[model samples]
Target: MAQLGSDLDATRAWSKARWRSELRAARRGVPASVRFAEAMALSNQLTSGRIVRPGQTLCGYVPVGSEPGSAQMLDDVADFGVRVLLPVVAGRGPLDWAWYAGPDSLRPGPYGLLEPIGERLSTTALRIADLVLVPALGVDRTGVRLGQGAGHYDQSLPLTAPGTPLVAVIRDQELVPELPAEPHDVRVTAVITPHRGLIRFD
Candidate 1:
């Protein structure tokens, strides 16, 4: 029985790895112009919608590489008088955060990410956020998020208070029917796509 469980775990890991590779490649295949346009549309959806309220502190990420949204979304959110916090990865542990002042405050960091160049906040700072915009390769109807393999958000999400709105940002087509779930995986509360805006999970 133990051997069976070990084998199953290995198989799931392999499956997740395969999915990550395929999804990342698909995102990369998109033309830069199209990605930019879609990102702008997504920014409009978020800023125009009621998902984020003024004066609310939002935990958001700076999109790197082929990630769906752009850093402009964070700026747009901040422009609404909302406080934006972005992640700062120090090592392999839970992600620390810092205030997103603007595009000028960002500096290149490890793993091709742009981190805030400000005072570092503890992981528990996530509890202060009214909403969190998480990056994802895909998300299913059940709120099961397919994240980058490094598990950065996975480690940090547990710090948020229960009932805090965790929304995954992905391309519309990346919202799929199902995904393999693991015991340690944290479910998202909603998903936001350029075309779909905000979608809630039951």
Candidate 2:
């Protein structure tokens, strides 16, 4: 157990350092115009394909800073009858979630990601979630995910049921063949890209 704990700490540190570098490169001001176009096209395809269901609690990310995907995807999730929830980064632990009513209820928060204007809820509330759209820096075919190095999602994801369908959202190019993995590094079951709505692994 001690060895596992130490490995998780080391992985967290490495992931965080890589995120700083990636964020700087992304924020250097070259627009994600191509990525945006691809993302929009992908969103439309997913909607048309009916890959999601209604009344299912779906955890989504606030697209800001270096994240990919369009606001259209977020809006569509709500419109499609899915109960959307956004991440509420409260501390160094697992991520908490709150109801995502709309963009109106979002306010700027840490790391440029939007937060709920109202109260945050407990992690147990996310137990009802059927799908979680994980934010990733990279993903591998074996279902391993590379996150922003913050153990937020890593901690939060396992709290869901074993087959809750975790999906990593990223650019197609970001989906590589392999990534450094650790015991606490949560693995995504599917990879969602601008070109691919959902790529199933296991």
Best by TM-score: 1
Tell me the TM-score of each prediction against the true structure. 0.91, 0.83
lDDT of each: 0.86, 0.73
Error of 2 at 162 (Å): 2.2
Q: Least accurate stretch of 10 residues (summed lDDT) in model 1? A: 1-10
- Compared with the true structure, what per-residue lDDT tens digits does model 1 show for residues 1-202? 1121124454344466776776787888899998998999888877784798888899999998999988888888889888999999969988999999889999999999999999998888999999999989988789999898788899999999888999999988787666788998999999989888899998
CA error at residue 30 for candidate 2, angstroms: 6.2
State the displacement of the C-alpha of residue 176, model 2, in Å, after optimal TM-score superposition.
0.6
Predicted candidate 1, C-alpha RMSD: 5.8
